[model samples]
Every structure is written in C-alpha cells, then in structure tokens.
Target: MNKRVGNQTVRLESKPRIISTATIVGPKEGEGPLRDYFDTILQDDLNGEDSYEKAEKSLLYSVITAAIKKANLKEQDINYLFSGDLLNQIISSNYAARDVDIPFIGLYGACSTMAESLGLASMIVDGGFANHAVASTSSHFSSAERQFRAPLEMGSQRPPCAQWTVTGSGAAVVGTEGNFPYVTYVTNGKVKDYGIKDANNMGAAMAPAAVDTIKQHFMDTGRTPDDYDLIATGDLGKIGRKITAELIKDYGYNMDNIYIDCGEEIYDAEKQGVNAGGSGCGCSAVVACGYIYKNLLSGNIKKALLISTGALMSPTASYQGESIPGIAHAVAIEFGGDKNE
Candidate 1:
C-alpha cells in the first residue's frame, strides 16, 4: 500500500513497537544531569579497554546486547541490526556487529544515526520484511576528537559555540507487537548546507536542516506543535536551538512551548564546563532511549517527535574547506495505543 504520506514522510500502518532499549554512557555523561536516566554508566572513560576507540566499541556492544536481553530475545531472533557511530568506517558499530552475529546494516548520518537506524528498522518491521530488528548508535568524545579534531592531550581551545561530543551508546529493539512505545511515522531529511564552515559550530550548521525536516514532518502529518507532548531535536545546543526557533516561527509554527534540545537538556552546561552542551550520535540516542522512553512508559508523555540531526562532514571535507552539510530524521513515537483505537 501507499505508506508514503508526503514527499519525505512515511505513515506506517503497522506501527512497529519499541520493545526494549538499553543505554550506556561514559564518566562525563554519567556525571551529567541525565545520569540517573541511563541504564548503565561506566565510571571510567576507557571502560577497562586499552584504547578509547575500543572502549567505544565496548559501549556499543553493551547497549546492543543489553537491549536484546531486555526484550527476552536472542541475537539470532533479531532479523536485522542497523547501527552506526562517529568513527572512520564506523569501526565501532562494525566490531559490535561482529560480536552480535546478526545481519547488519551499517549507516552513517553523522550524529543523526540513531533516528536513521530507527526509521529504517520501523519500515522493515512494518513492511513484513522482518518481525524484529535492532537499531543502535554510539559516539565517544575521545574517539571523535581524534577523528575530527586534535588529540585530547593537544588541549585544543574549544570555542563557546563548540559542543562536547557525548560518550555513550543507545539501542532499541523494534518488533511487530509489544506494549511499549510504538513508532508510527518517520520523516527522512535532506542534506542542507547554509554556507557555514566552522566545524566547531555544528549547531549553527545543522539547525537549518533540523528546521526543514521538522516543518516537513508537521506539514505531511497535518499536525502542529500542540499535537505532541514533546518535540525533541538531537544536539542543536543553544545557538542552533535559537536559530531553529526563529526559522520555525517564520514558517508559522510556534515551538517555544514544546521544543527541547537533547544537547541543552543533557547537562548542566555551566557546571559541566562543556562549552556548548553535547553533540554526537549518542547525545540524542541515550536521551531518547533512556529519559524519553521511560517518561512515555510512565504515561508522562503520550506522543513525542524525536528529530535527530547530523552534520555530515568528514575530516577530509572540513580539511578541504568544505561547508558542513546537515541532515535530520524525524520519528514519531506513541505509547499504549490499540491498533483500532
């Protein structure tokens, strides 16, 4: 049938359910305001590994395995695994997949990977192509820094607008039937670059992409900000959040009441000493899976729209003086809904 609702949105008739979720964070994130919401917290950034990169892989492995276990499903029971990370070749997710023994689909949407994987998994399960699927994403501050910037010891001067890359991983299992939160729709974003070239200022670069996707989501669904209990966007710290608000207002949608940026809410920015809060694949992943998922389960929220935005720029692109292109994917999740009702 015509699952396509609008130009970029898909209205899933099957409503794939998020059966279970697991989130793991490093020491910094564990010390943040949302510390209590996470499923697992590693006291050490290295997580008992010899290298930070390996530790990131460990985080991904822990979350994926824990999500499968929480759902009472074995690795073999999952028909597909969609995962990604902020690493060259996505080595973190690649190695994690090696340990899980599931058919894997590696994706790269920069930091928007969590929503990207979730959207794909929802479609697969809703289309009868799979009964169960796992969607996961991870990011590490040390690994990202080494990949995209300088080494930790280099003591690079971070600008006020620069965001801290979150050290964490989150995974969720999407199945045909469950009593948990259900994914009802998805909106895949388009790459948009607004001539911004500062790698540190990711929020500014990605804000427009987020606004475009959110506007498309509302237009396609014929919904407004009031329709959902919350509208959360991936990173977008303070600067990006402001820009998004202004742009959305220009589009005739007032988001002042319901909007929350995961990066801004994840930490006590002043106390944490993080210049511009957090930004990474794990930033939105952990917040959505840990904090938002629990709130939905407790009936605190009936409907939520999570827009995970990514800066699709590689070290090579940045080095070449190319402007950062941004993308965002939106997923609508609802809890405790009957199929007919």
Candidate 2:
C-alpha cells in the first residue's frame, strides 16, 4: 500500500501529513535543571502502585499540554487523540488524556508508538475523516525499570551499550494537506532480531531494525542518502548508530555526512552517565518536537527523514529466551519549497 513519487516515497495508507509538532518536559520550562527534575520525579513520592505508570502519566500530560500550547488550539477542537505508552493497557496515556475533550484511540507499538500514531493520524486527515488530529507517546526511567527489570534502588550496573530511558514526552498535530510541513515519505519495518541476551545493550538488539528500515526506505523510493538533508534515527545509541552506518555502507549508500541519531543528540555522553545514548519512546519524540522542529522553523535544515526504531521484546519475552524483535518506521518532513530556499 505504498508508492514512490519522484524522489519521495509515500504510503497510500498513511496520507495527509503532519503540520505541527511539539515536545515538552514535564517539570515546567525553568524548573531547575532538566536532569535534576527527572531524577527527583523518579525518586520522589508518587501516589501510584506502579512507579512507571505515574512517570508515564506525568510525561504524557506535559507533552499533550505543550502540543496544545504550541499548536494554539483548544483541547475541545481536537476531534481525536491517538496515543500510546509502554505500560499495560496504556494506563498512563489514558489517565493523562481523560481530562482532554477529544476522543481517544490507544495504540501499542513498543517504542514505535510515534510512527503508529503519525501514520494513523495522517490517514484520518487524508481520508477526510477528520481535519485536525494529534499523536503522542511517552516513557520514563523509574516506570520502565520497575516494569521491565528491577526496582529503582536495585543499584544494578547497565552494560556499555545500555541506554537510559528519556524522561519526557512528544506530540504532534496533523491537518489537511496545505503549505504546512508535510510527511513526504514513510516505510514500515518488519520485526528483526539479533539474539542478543543482554538487556542493557539495546543498541545491539535494535541495530538490525534501524538498518532494515533505512535500507527499505531507499529501496522503496529509489533515492539515496544524498537526497535527504539529514537522515535521523529515533533512539539508536552509540552502538546502534555505528552498526547502522556499516549496514548502510554495505547497501551502497553513504550516510556519513547527513546522519543524526536522537539518542546521541540530546545529552552529552561525558556529562551524563549514559554510556551510549538515550532510549525509550520519549527520545525520538522530544528530539523531533524540540530540536528538529526548531531547526526546520529557522531554515537550518530541510528535507529530513525521521526513523523511529523500537525493540519489540518485553521482559517476559526475554525471560522466556525469546530473541528480541525490532521494528522501525521512517517519516520524511520537509520545510518550505524552492521559493523559501
């Protein structure tokens, strides 16, 4: 259900396009240091049985509120909300969205929630089912840790390639096609695994998925890396980025000049304890909303490809000796036409 047009690839199933995106931090704009607030929320008292759910809710609220503020629209005007998180039954997103007036459609794509949301939202807008729609996703460290591994105070050491879950949220609004930023292309990835046992090395586990999507994007569009001003991946840590580069080179594409990974872009490796980079649903969302949007608005970069990658294996699946499955989806965003350039 996908086709290519000129140098762009479009998904017939995912039409319309994203108009505006906003990402926000939970603990207010000037609320002390970013890392400090995240740590406090994780360690502080929260009135939920599940720490992860609490954190997730907080982040989701921050993102949705930010999206509303940035888009300059009232909550009631939004007809539908397509959202997802890592928690069971999407408790965090559901609880956070309850106060909003829009209808809700919960989704699950592990780390690929953003792509799923954008895809569905675009379809709704393109099909004339709705004019304005919002898609969002979130994740937190404390909640993800407790649910997937050990308690917060377990004091376990992460592997070299381990990625810290980003404690934030991201949301975007998609409207009917116009002069706004449009989703020029999209490509879905099949689940692929490398059979890596270490839970910490998500980069090793997810590298295959990243490569698969990047390769497929080129194949589907018949465009090389040179066509994009920047080819970005969601949360591929240092390890995964390297692997992705190798894979792209093997496929006869050199993405060295215009490649960026959200995980590596957000935090400083030396300053932060993160050995490789950041992960979780928030990583890609925040970067796209905050950094990418800003750059696009200011004309710093245009024609960017955002590929959100996810590890499809849960703790239970890993415990059962199941190989980690991963998936990724690529969405191209273009700002201004030749006139602006």
Candidate 3:
C-alpha cells in the first residue's frame, strides 16, 4: 500500500501515469528558446480577446481540450479537473472549467498551483478515488502585471530582480494505465515568510521556501540529487536559483550539477530581456509538460524531481506592507514506457 513518508511526503505505490499534456503560450513566450516545446503559440498576448483575463481563460480552455485530445480522451472521460491561475478569484480557471463542463476543483497556491494540482490529481488516481483526472494551471503576463504590480498603461519600470510573468497555460492528463511518466511521490511544503517586503525581489522572498521543500523531500525519500536525472524548480529565476543552491548547501546538500530551474531554462535571458527570468503559474507548468514530459516520453530522461515554487503574495498584501510568503511543492516522476514494447 502507498503510505506517507516522513511528515509531508506521500509515496504513491500505484504510480499514476501522466499519459498526455498540452501547452499554449503568447507571442513573447513563443519567441523564447522553448518555442518548439509548446503545443500552441498565439500570435498576440490578447489571443483575439479584448481583455488579458479573457485571454488567460481562453489559453486554459484550449490547453485542457488539447490535453484531453492528446490523451485520446473526451471531456466526459475526466473524473475531475484541477486548475488555478494568478488572477483574483482564479477567474481564468473557473471560466475555463465552465467551458469544459468537467467537475472542477479550483486551487490556489499562487504560482505553485501547477505542482499542487499535479500532486492532488496523482493522489486521487492512485487512491482509486478517480481513474482519470486533469491538472492544469495558467498565467498571463498582462493580467499578472495588472493584478500584482501595475497596469500596462502605467508602464511601471521593473526592478532588476523582478521576473517576467509567463503568458501561457499547461495541462496534463493522468491515469493508472499508460506507458508514460508516472508520479511516484509528492512532498507538500509549508508557508515560509522571511519578512522581505520588497515586492520587486520575489526571487529572494521565495528562495527559502524552495530550499525548505527541497531539503525535506530529500530527507523523506532518502534520495540524493544523483538519484534522479534532473531536479528542477519552477519560477525561481536566476537570483532565486542561486539563493536556493546556497541555502541547500547550507542544509548539507550539494545540488550544483544535478539541479536546473524552469525559470532559467524557459528563455534566453539576454535575448528576451526577461530580467531575472520567468515566474507566474504557467512558468513551471509549460516547461514540465512541454520540455520535461517530452524528454521522459522519449527516454531522454529516466527519472526526475520537479519542485514548483510560488510567492504567495498579492497586491493587497503588498499594499498592506506585509512580507511576501512563499510555498513550494515537489513531485517525483519516473518514466514508465510501454510495457509490451
């Protein structure tokens, strides 16, 4: 039987497989280095919608449909759809679920929502609560800016440490039967706030949380960085990546060569002018579904650990002069190729 390991980690004996996935991104993200990995790329950020919020919803809807289609399943086949976004009330995910007509459970972990969704969906399948489920998350640059920072028209100057919000959505279909990457374990994180009030430096604010989760995951699984082909973190741009590395070393683990960050890999920083790098809910989601998932399917990667970090702060929180709180969730995935083949 699958059982809980340590305090926060759950080991899934059934190994729910991620059978298929889909990704959609805006023009800016389309031009990034990971362009070929995406399933759909919009010509513009608006995506034929009048508002950025609507565009985010459309992205979510398209990605979810595409994921189901890729899995050779229909909307009716999904037992539950887990999704969320950075917008207030998670309106993008809510509206997308309404369009898809699937039983919906909205989640909110800020940008860590993708990992949260994936972890929960995998548990549902492994526990036999549901045979098939979809995990999805999205974020739009414009929408995130308007809600978290400033309106586009305001043209607020971003500080050097600020990361760019990814305008995209990613969805994954998971089930018990498939020759694909299987989720083996999940380590949920606790909220950590270091009392850093600089909204522009989110990487610094979230680094400790990422470090905490990574350390705890290693302890729970009794695995080192060398146990997996790669260990990736979500949205912890260059600054946070460095901080995480140093902090993890301080925790007595050296993750220098085996670790990579989705934020750092998603774009060519110099060419894209993305400052620190990519953040937002879609940053890790798209990279996982598009790049890492494909690699696993092709046997380019045997096993990996994906840790998604999120800054659990809002504009209201910032305005209230509250420190940014951060959280991270990790999932261990192994390639389970076609058995018959």
Clash-forming residue pairs, model 2: 52-143
| Residue range 1-341, candidate 3, lDDT tens digits | 74899988999999899999999988988899899999999998898999999999999999999999999999999999999889999999999999986899999999898899999999999999998999999999999998888788987888889899999999999999967899989999999999988877888888999999999998998887777888899998999999999999987888899788888888888899889999999999999999899988888888878998999987787888889999999998889442212
TM-score of each: 0.98, 0.87, 0.97
| RMSD in order of candidates | 1.6, 4.1, 2.3
Question: Which candidate, 2 or 3, would have the higher TM-score against the true structure?
Answer: 3
Query: Between candidates 2 and 3, which one is better according to lDDT?
Result: 3
Give the lDDT of residue 45 in candidate 2.
23
**Could you arrange the candidates by lDDT from highest to lowest?**
1, 3, 2
lDDT pick, better of 1 and 2: 1
lDDT of 3: 0.91
Q: Write the per-residue lDDT of candidate 2 for residues 1-341, one digit (tens) a residue.
A: 23544332455444455666766543321132233322123333232435557757876876676676666678876778999887777788899889677889998777777776776777677667887889899877667877777887989887778887777778888877555666656676778888877778777788888888888888877778877888888888888899899888988999999998888776676567778988888778777766776666667777788888888768888878887777887877777653223
Instruction: Give a tens-digit lDDT track for model 1, residues 1-341.
Output: 99998789999988899999999998888999999999999989899999999999999999999999999999989999999999999999999999988999999999999899999999999999999999999999999998898898989899999999999999999999868899989999999999888889999999999999999998998888888888999999988998998899988999898899999988889999888889999999999999899988998888899999999878888778889999999999988643223
lDDT of 3 at 220: 91
Q: What alpha-carbon RMSD in Å does predicted model 3 have with respect to the real structure? A: 2.3
